[model samples]
Target: MASKQDTAAQGTPVSGGTASQHTTPPKPSADAEDAAKDKKPGTVSIDQDVEDKDHQLPPHPEPLPPQHPSFIHCMPPKNPAITKNKHSVFLAGSIEMGNAVQWQPHMVKRLHHLPITVCNPRRGHWNTSIIPAKDDMDFKTQVEWELKALDDVTVVCFFFDHNTRSPVTMLELGLLAEKHKVVVCCDKRFWKSGNIHIVCGKYGIPYCETFEGLVGLIMKELKKNDLDVDENGKLLSEPSSAD
Candidate 1:
């Protein structure tokens, strides 16, 4: 029987401290269920306590490519006789001497696409007669025409065959060696191979064994000069390199 004033003076457990102090709310019913689920086998979340791995992943690599092929003939352009600003090349080689076939036509066919005027003597007028007669008009005309070409041309190509005695070809070489640019290709079996090689050596001209070699040298020279001549001596729309 404490007096009201005395009771007020003494501090009482304002709330039910002793009973509730150590007590937690009965975990919400679902909380036990959640814990039970977590304890259940294989209950992992993709986004659990695991770390974000995008930044830790090793980088992905790139991929690769393929391969290609090669060439046979240094082929010329499809069309050659089409331009005005073209160079000139004279085919000064064996006619009826060694191979029995004239190479001028073949040379023209190969080089026709180039910006060049090919002066082929084989195309010039001639007869069944072996030698040109000093008095024959057609022979004289042919001779004069060829001689004039030598004077006017930019390059002279000398090809010697082994079968025939091409004395005139030799003379043409000597005459034009100093005056014009000359490319000499002499067959080893030519009667005057030694003499011709000596002359080419003296003049510092390109001397080759095969006709194909001669063409290669000419193309090289053209490339060096940066002339319109293509890699194969054709005037191509898109200048390409030899393969």
Candidate 2:
């Protein structure tokens, strides 16, 4: 048997010899030592493998939102009236067949709801006399009144029923359209197929068969204008791309 000191010396592994190889823990460098000394005692030191694994994960990006279209705001609280450049509608029809009694008042009411001034010279029976008289003075007077009504309106809403409309109403329409008012010719006649309807169609004027329908059509056109008038009754006209 070898002596105790000789056995111990022989058991130690040399550079060229193989024994039970034990790896020594890596020593801290001068900078690492300084960093370790400055750090808190329980601070975790991440290995290169751990750092690389953390960086390897794909980044989660923030989600994006979808896009949408804009809409017009509805009528405002105590909505202002339309501008002076707005087209006023003239209710033209007959006194009989209860056209004035039933429709004119309702039409006028609707106009009040809008930013428009409705002019109906034939609000009573007196104005209807012009339809039959055909007298030069009477016709001239009617013409002047009709023209005066059209002076401020950018458009005309003419209401004529087969039972009520006469030659005078026709003449009134001609003057309004000639003055370039956007003519809205409506007929609530129970029996329509007449010369008046043909004339309205030829002139390219829009007409509705019922009062409610007519109101809807007129409102649609007014919305296109998007105009606003001042509180002092000063009218401001906005440019409209739609006719």
Candidate 3:
């Protein structure tokens, strides 16, 4: 028979394994522990659902492949007087508040006095963003609006300065040129002013370099249109001395 001391020296067995050799296996790494917690036996994780909770998405939803926007044609309001006068003018320019304020009010007031009807885009006027037009309103819409405003008006009046060469203005120019309207471009600065000069020259449209000169050109056209009528339409030909 073995003595008790001899048995202790060989180590003790509990059930199937040695008691001293057994451990709680060693606590797993944080990642391993989390992974083990996430996984279930014989089942796969839904990866899409997991990713959705952790990710941010775009504001506008992802569009479908081969998408096409529906195209709609729109026209501007018409006035009977524009047809009878046979001279309609469209005024377009930059919305720079300080300097632009000079010509804009003057031009609008002058058009009100004339027999011709004016189609001035009432955007960014006294207040900005009065109407929130979409960025996608195309040149076709602008031109069609002006054209619809005219009954028989054949002429367009506008000035080109640095402010006038914006994308919208360029689009307006293209539309007017296509219709063979005489363009009157003015330049506020020498360098910025010449773009319209070339465009007008290329398209057989008239151009001026100064606001005063443009005013003269407009008067000349109006006089030519009236033929026998008085040059001043119920207003003094020259600016009032009191003003």
How does each model score on lDDT? 0.48, 0.39, 0.39
- Native-to-model Cα distance after best TM-score fit, residue 144 in candidate 1, in Å: 0.8
Which ranges of candidate 3 are over 4 A from the true structure? 1-81, 84-86, 96-102, 123-144, 150-152, 161-165, 188-192, 226-243
Indicate the residue-level lDDT of 116 in model 3.
Answer: 49
Residue 180 shift from truth in candidate 1, angstroms? 4.3
Candidate 2 per-residue lDDT over residues 18-57, each given as its tens digit: 1122222223223334444554543433201111111111
Model 2 error, position 23 (Å): 99
lDDT of 3 at 104: 39
Query: Residue 97's C-alpha lDDT in candidate 3?
Result: 29
Clash statistics: count for each candidate: 3, 1, 1
User: Which is the winner by TM-score between candidate 1 and candidate 3?
Assistant: 1
1-243: candidate 1 lDDT, tens digit per residue? 101110000111011111111111112122223434544343322111212121111111111011112111111111222122334567787765223334444444444445445666643222345356788775676677778766755567776655657788998998876653677667566788888877776767767655555554556555554555544444444334422
In order of appearance, the predictions have TM-scores of 0.57, 0.46, 0.46
> What does the lDDT come to for candidate 1?
0.48
Model 2 spans with C-alpha error above 4 angstroms: 1-87, 96-100, 123-142, 177-180, 183-192, 228-243
